[model samples]
Target chain A: MTSGPADAGEAMGSAARAPTGGMPPSRDRGAPTEKGTATPPPGTGQAAVGAPVITDVAGLQTVIDTLAGQGYTVIGPTRRGSAIVLAEIGGTQDLPQGCGDSQDAGTYRVTDRRDEAFFGFAATPQSWKAFLFPSRELLWSGAAAPGRLTVTPDPAPGKPMAFLGVRSCDLHAIYIQDRVLLGRAYTDPRYAARRADAFIIAVGCSDPSSTCFCVSMGTGPAPSAGFDLSLTELLRDGRHRFVARAGSERGAAVLACLTAPTAGPDDLSAAQAVTDTAAAHMGRHLDTRGIRDLLYASADHPRWDDAASRCLSCTNCTLVCPTCFCASLETVPDLTGEHLTRQRVWDSCFTSGHSHLSAGSVHGTTRSRYRQWLTHKLASWVDQFGTSGCVGCGRCITWCPAAIDITQEAAALRVPAPHDPAPGGEPA
Target chain B: MRKLAVWKFASCDGCQLTLLNCEDDLLPLTDQVEIAYFPQATRAVAAGPYDLSLVDGSITTPADAERIRQVRAVSRRLVSIGACATAGGIQALRNFSDIGDFSSAVYARPEYIDTLATSTPVAAHVPVDFELNGCPIDKDQLLTVITAFLRDSKPDIPSHSVCVECKQRGTVCVMVADGIPCMGPVTHAGCGAICPSYGRGCYSCFGPQDTLNTRSLAGRFAFLGMPEPAVARTFRTFYAAAPPFATESSMHSGGGR
Candidate 1:
């Protein structure tokens, strides 16, 4: 076994002296591209630029430790009160190493991972949204007296928050939120500042969770883009190493500080193979080709009334969704009728007051409310935003007190795709 | 001297809260209409012969039956508020199960509570100028209906199903892509289809649309693998007393006529 500073220095020097300016080779010369970096199509998953070859577990710790020294607030997965939460990490010792989690409707719990790998599983119950757009934040405050008014906008500053092991699905979630909050015609300055300042160093998932449907959403088992840097862990001799790649200038700068080697073909191929294995083993599956037509055709369908009966008209699903954007304004007056403050808060269609009118009338019954929610998420969302409002996150299914699963509902209404040719039809 | 009164019985104060919920709209509305007898908002209970009475909730007791008839005689125009007023609210779940068993199971002293074997809608006993659907009606639409009635114009509440509203909003089909169940096609259009936009299914809080095809939709529900009992149970909630939904659910129940 190698010992002391000279051996460590030699390891760094060997990586530095590799022949290739980019990725290093670690595999057979005659191997096919299947043994090389597996490239999925664009918008699916992409390999990170300048992928680094991580040989063993010690190499993984070296990269993580180097980043902590460079003034970045490194956050990674850790067990937090029955759930796996992303929290501040001091070093590799702080990771939920060799631990995995079980997630389902209204429940989430972590278990022993068997292998002490850093990022080996699918989505956790907690989403990245908890950090970006918190449940409650004071947008602005104001006090009025005799037209002498004082207003102060809430201070929303962007800190250098570095995410150590983000999943591909969550990366897509961030993109969805980007469109909702930052990319919209009216930008949310608070959300924008928070997102722009944050740096993502993702760890591609080698295993998918039972609740995961990222493959259907075309999100992923591995992060293709959006992150500044990505890693894939390879365990050998009880030491876990990572296949690292830079996605931006910032990522390149971060990579420069670490003692990672140029990625050989063996490391790249192994990472690709790991990502493929994860993709092939997705826990959930969806067939969406003819779903639109099925719903449209079944309009005036009896299923509406049938499903609505058990629904409690509670708004739990909307509250937990990453893409739901409906909100309303409420104005309250002080003791004197002279002054009032208007505030906007989350509103759900299920709440009885949501539809109450001046004539003292409510519009839609529980059945209609349930129907509206399902149709809008499945059918109408496509017509308006050109994107499904749902990210296939399964949060709504799990959080519903009634135990309603949207996936099951879709499967029950299957219809043949209109465009699919007959068995004997020739190619167009 | 046009009189306008607000009334409530047998329901959560949600519909009444809506009037108060109208922040900027409340001042203008009060300026236009007389605040005659709204017990929830003010202590004022002006005498009857009121021009308009906005009634909330259903008649579930013998006393309520007497009160509605008297209120009807005193007011020229009576508009029912929320599902409780128009469709009997969640209490309408009693329409499916025997009221005797339900009452006995829920209350420790069943005799103490004022008794009615069945919960009936406002339109059942008294004449109603309009019956807005939903657990609570859409505020702007309710305001529009009020102003329109005052102007002698027909209220512009759409008789269209939730499907049209979904089309207008351009939301994706959750049923199609995610296999989510939805009731939008047969349910009345209102509330802008809020639930689905937030990645959830509609629960049909606005009730049935005109020209509903429950038989065919039920076939689809069966196709989706929903059991007969489960489907029947769902239809018997919220607006369970409404004719189309009520009748369809009865057909699935063993006791149905």
Candidate 2:
């Protein structure tokens, strides 16, 4: 199973590959690290690994232009009504410039950052999943005529995509989904095809919202790996620039086409400082120390009831969660009774039909449904995938009408269960 | 091919329009199921004993109550579409008041009018095989129900709240963030969370979910500074007569057992 461009080098050799050098390839940079290790390696400009380059606002625009010139659809965060959503961009003018967002539990508002920083926003309502695994897609078409049935599969993504302004948490989320859709026992052909052809332009988070907790999840504030090009926006004293590093040969080739200068020591330090500040300023934290065991042991905890009291069972947590990958099938037939089409759509665990059985839905109670979701995300996901399902992007918290916080719920599970006294025993 | 029938009672015909609005799939859907009894689409009407029936609207009149019973008896599988068929629609608000007063106020001659004291769901009059929740049911969901019935499979209509759709669409919660009182937690899904995505709270047009905790949501609305009357009024919207919502509204309004 191919994980990224690194694993599929021979297959993607036709495209630009990572240059061979003494410095380890970016794909190997997925090694897990602890807190306080967010700084980039020392040395600046051409001396540093992959030779980090410094580019101004125009240079970044040129990168967008270059990707467009290469026949790639450039997608970035832009203003859509009151929220900032990821959408197709024609040029740099389409990016969310001089804009940021304020996010809290069950609260989200687009605010002017009052600066010229382009990648100022944190997270959007839509993720890169919309491109790779669309909400709705036709699987195949079938036609039957006089005891003969013919089926034709749908074609894969036609145009390649250059996803810009992807945050570190979202980058990790993509990798997690990659493991589910591609690196699993059964590969999803559509997902694999889209992932192979798409180019990722990951941006480090310099402005985390109040709902963000990537630092605790060890997924963000700074990108570790799995990117074609990683960027860190540097805005100071009314001047804006970006520190760009090539993680692959394709990324280097694209950077080579730009007229940006090699990053100096000051630029590198400034970039490092940006990520460090973000890491320190994380708005939320999840102490994952034995979180799996804590949740499993607390299945009958009273906190589930408390959570259920406020819980709407709306499936919001699962839907916004980038790692939740449940789906349902839909079949439609033509009026002639000869033609039919099967489609796949996004499904949520909170839905009663998700766990439907012949007798009835397995998770009939709100408490049971909430328990199942939490247990799967924080505990059982480790058994299914080698990693946790949550990337701590905080979309679930901000999008929940009830403002339910998963981290808070998990933390609440840590509270010691009430002692059940023996019969006739005194109450504690 | 399976014979399908579409019936209506007391509604705006929005749910039927949703079916017609499936411009791309309408032709394909016609091929799968024979339109045995759809007045909105065709002039021809086929005899009953249909394989499936999609009934929209509510039983607001004594005549509608008997009509629904007849529709149920003639169909093998009957699925209710829209809030009207599932939870009595916006007209159900009259269930709390005297129908005599309503008839006298709205009609020129109360003696000529013939109406029921309350509006109720299809299930109240007949046994429904399935219920698709929405104000105007989502076309995709409606198609799924019909397809499932044709295949003799369980329909995949979710009984969860609207919060799921809002989260999937990445819509910021208007209730929690803006302090707007939203019924998304207690309301059913299928509108794809359109209101919240447009910066508005859910109006519960799809009706109450199967496992609705109306009392808890009512408490939250009150905690969010919604006045007692507003909290009661919130539950008395589209699906006001739905049991859970109805009970909660009455409890908060300090009236009725």
Candidate 3:
């Protein structure tokens, strides 16, 4: 691959303007349109595959503005309650450009970066899941009245959203949700409608959160998959810039409307270096060796009783989990019984009311409830989903009022194989 | 008539809320099973001699002990819900320490409080037909168990550990990614590993499964730098008085019951 100003212009000329039939690029930050352009072929950003790199925030704004002009809502991070939360943004001014977050157990605070850098840091409390799956949503609404039981579907996907600064782990979380909600067993039309029409603009993390364990889960410091466009923030000669690469065709079309610099070997390698650093600096680690047998064999071990004693039985941990798919539904009726609407809400196993059947009875004890929750998360979910149910994001530990850390608990039970020494030379 | 009743003794109203939280499925479930005495859902209370009963909370008082026996006598098939009904619950913390002093330490009116010296599950005083494991059972699992029982099929809830659910969900082992403590390996599976699934560690809400090996798990927690007493104290939480958990917690403290 040759790197020169002349070649850069040629590449820029060829990559500009989308080559398909969907919503055209917008002119500002606003709501996205229902329609979207056809995606560019895959491998658009690969060196051998000709990936384009964008270098200016202002230039990036031009592309965002173009999309907004075409009637699309651009959503990203905005300041809220001392932290930058993912929300709807109107322009670059609305973004937390030079700010990052500090996350620890039960503590999340926003801090200023000395340099004015965009996309300078890592994981935040907010993940893309909040937008795609709001806390409360109406699944179906209908009349319970005679001769009329019509169920209304969820609202149409909000004006095609353009997620401006999604992280890799959050993006993967969205995909995981997709599999759960829109799998072979059943399809969630509302989820599909919103997801299909959305645009993803991902930013590669330079500084991972101390609470982040995405590297161990292979989620990433740099996005490897599931993004339309990916970005890397760089600093040179006191200048702040973003190196944007097209992951899909829609990404390439957006690039066409902006001014982008052809990335050199140094730019690409620096990006790689940042990702490697984040991976190596993981704040925590888990020892999974022989975990299955150890947990299975240790079922009657004395540990359950010890753990049950301290557990407050609050559902704080569940509320913060990214992949917890458990949900319950309820129907509320309006006066006169004219209409009934079904609402879906998150439910947790840590509560006392979840187990009731018919008569005034329950199964298991508090011990049983605690044991069931832990066992299912670590072992049984594998049988059901063909994969462990956790992504090791550490949100549960950070937000837990009781400060319970699942990684330490699992490590405690692990009886290492003869070959493996205990992780960190000590149990959790 | 198919009579149904929802009962509580000493627990947070979490399990009953689970039924209420059963958005679309709740009405359909109510159509099949009578909602006779769920105070959380309806003010219309039905007297029991019930065909089926779903009991929540624990027997923390003398009155609770007697009420449980009566509840068992009337119900054809009685099920216990949440950790409180199945184990002693967090209040079972009383089982380990000096109840008198402990109560006085926390309460301003300890003299007025009429709590039992020990918190116990309903099954301790009366026979239970089924046990739904969870601090609050997975509403889906609860539904599955009920629907299956009505149809004469064994409820297909997993008897395995939270580790199994974690693997099935493709969640990376939290113990590996974050050097945090977790109880997912030995805990039962009703919360669908909610805590771990959300990038957090598991706080066993669903109690012990059919078979549990808690000793080795305790060893692991110790290895992770949790002191022995802390380890024992952790086990004594929500299900403190249950046999397996209680016995294990006591043993961890080297204070045999």
Candidate 4:
């Protein structure tokens, strides 16, 4: 419990490297994206369990460089267009410094945080899922001859990835995805291959956007588990530093290579205070208590019709959700007449086509499709995956063109409409 | 080889040019289909009863209406290609106003111009086997249609919204993050979401999707500060005659020209 699991260091299979200054002149921006060391998580980043080490701004830069130098493609949150999106970052120079965001249903705008803290923004539009489970990827390619068809399965993508500034909700979303993809029934080798080589450096959420409800979900203002490292950026009186914790030995190894010192009591308290404030200021909240039962009980409720009236059925909600993993395979024959390829592309339940079978869609109306998505996400997903599909990151709400807040919609389902005879009456 | 004929009505021949754009790919395709009567590609003209006809525009004139029937009579499978052939194109804007007024505004002599009072899709006049959607239909999709026909299979053109393609291509939603009024929610998937990828809102060169709530999307556009007339006009463009879009636009079009 004290500095993670006792066997974590042994699990790393290698001793830590001597500390480096990680200063300029040695800063290589050209270090391509890749990953190296892997350490299994002991799932401990709690103050009650273990104390975290605090480091200065230069230390943040060191972490980036060291990760990059170790052949990891360091993906970090940065200002892209009007939102902070994850992209390949070589160093701290690529971080979203002095930039925060204001988010509401169907709205997001990058704001001047008016301070020089990296990772000041809320959750990004595109999650880490985009990298781990891409929207489109080649499944296989084949060439057909007169009597033979030579098929070639796609190779796992090259280069391991190190994600910088991953959120606590996003980390949970990743785990949920792992359960779905790497569960007992079947394993997606492509997803497994990508996930095995990936490193997570989760940043604690000290600022939740107007659409955020991670507090209500109890996922965090700070990560409890499932990270190589957890970083809580603290900008105190003329002091900008991070209270960093190693969730796994690989994270500890990365920290050992940086010129970081063990944190004093003051730094740990300061870090705690940041998360404490964030926990209070959650802009949105969802009552998850019996949410699945509520949804299951409200199948005949007229609320779905109200939602369907506003829903564009554009697949934006599912696409933005990091946990909603549904894909469609398309067979593409080449102009060469001999070559053919099958590709896996992202699909959503919002589309009637997603339910297309028997030469017709089972869910014809928007009301039916909306009900399927809502119930499946909040209800059946728990039955199937043993967990609620929503991490309450509020991506679905923020990215929805109709400004349909899932939290508000979920709450509304509990209340009976005036026209309805009862909550669970005959279908409207 | 199967004979392929490219025909035109009131279009700018952009969709026909898309076939030419497939320079390298077209070479092998040429082996399967004979380019019998693509007047734009060659001075070549074949007699009646073509294997496949690619019609690229709306039926705007009296002569055009007659010609489309004759083309359908000859062609084995009639594929309506591009926005004009599918939804009456941008030229269909004249459908709203008096054709005399539009002719007077553009033509030196309004009396000299030969045009119908309304430009309507080829489907308005005759049965189309398949309709390829776009202002200038994507060459790849056009090829897919032609290739499918050559194999005697149904063309694999999706009737899904442009948002599906946008998300698949990993183009960040312009309407969501930027608060821009985008036509992507209702527009059919084609053009691979080119406009949003370029940081511009989709102008909906490809017609409306089969499954879309235009009324709901119109509400969103109005919320994004697009005036009722502007919202009406947005749906009216490129796909002016597509029923759902035209109906939605007509609801708001009374506010302005």
Model 4, A1-428: lDDT tens digits are: 11111121211212222111110011111121111101112133342223578888789889888888888898988777766878898788888899988999999888998898898778788788899889888878899898998889787678988888888888878876766665433456666667777888888898889999887776777877777788999999988999998866688888887747788899989988988988888899887777766787788787888999999988899998998888766677765558888777777887777778766887788888888988988877776666677888999999898899999989898787778665545533
Please report the candidate that would top lDDT against the real structure. Answer: 4
Candidate 4 to truth, TM:
0.91
lDDT of prediction 3 = 0.64
> Clashes in each model (backbone N, CA, C under 3 Å)?
74, 9, 169, 6
Worst 10 residues of 3 chain B by lDDT: B167-176
RMSD of each: 14.0, 5.9, 13.3, 8.6
The interface RMSD values of the models, given in order, are 13.0, 3.3, 12.5, 1.4
TM-score of each: 0.54, 0.84, 0.56, 0.91
User: Whose TM-score is greatest here?
Assistant: 4
lDDT of 1 at B101: 85
What is each predicted model's overall lDDT from 0 to 1? Answer: 0.63, 0.77, 0.64, 0.80
How well does candidate 2 match the true structure in TM-score terms? 0.84
Quick one: best DockQ, which candidate? 4
- For model 4, the DockQ equals 0.64
The list of candidate 4 runs beyond 4 A from truth reads A1-51, A419-422, A425-428, B100-114, B253-257
TM-score of chain B of each: 0.94, 0.95, 0.91, 0.95
Q: Per-residue lDDT of A314-391 in model 2, one digit per residue for the tens?
A: 766677777778876756764354778877767776767777777878888889999899888877776655567788
C-alpha lDDT (0 to 100) for residue A329 of candidate 1: 45
State in Å the error of residue A21, model 1: 23
lDDT of 4 at B55: 95
